[model samples]
Target: MLNGCYLTPPEPKVITITKPVPILPPLYLLNDIALSHPPINTNRELLKFAVKAHNQKVLCNLDKAALRAWRAKYE
Candidate 1:
């Protein structure tokens, strides 16, 4: 007897599990919300055509109060 009774070896089992990620809300929801707001729609259109320096792209907000004050002085 060699180290307790030894029979056939255990079989090898390979299990493969794959997980997927979902990108939610979909395109239709985005389109609907975009249509609901006028300012957002206008901003989106402006972004499509507005061109700025490569380093300053996507930065479009300005200080309305300061701009109004400056314009008032000139008026």
Candidate 2:
């Protein structure tokens, strides 16, 4: 009879440090954050929308924590 299990090297322990990320303020509250300046060659409107959405997602606590957890798990 042959052994099914194979000897493998032990996994390394990983240490992660987490920091609080600031949330994005409301549009009306922060006027400058509302506008985005993209390349002249590209579509300005689409870029503006995309930038706003990206900023909001980055500033969200749940979103940031979820992302951090996923990164830690994979890394």
Best by lDDT: 2
Per-residue alpha-carbon lDDT of model 2 for 1-75, expressed as tens digits? 455576677899898999866554433432223344455565777777688778775676455565565555544
Off by over 4 Å in 1: 1-7, 32-75
What candidate 2 gets wrong by more than 4 Å, as runs, is 1-42, 61-75
Specify the poorest-scoring 10-residue window by lDDT in model 2: 25-34
Error at 8, model 2, angstroms: 75
Candidate 2 clashes between residue pairs 3 or more apart in a chain or in different chains = none
Question: Candidate 1 on 1-75: residue-level lDDT in tens?
Answer: 586776888898999999864434333322211112134357656565443332233222233334444555555
Report the number of the highest-TM-score candidate: 2
* Residue 31 Cα positional deviation in candidate 1, in Å, after optimal superposition: 1.2
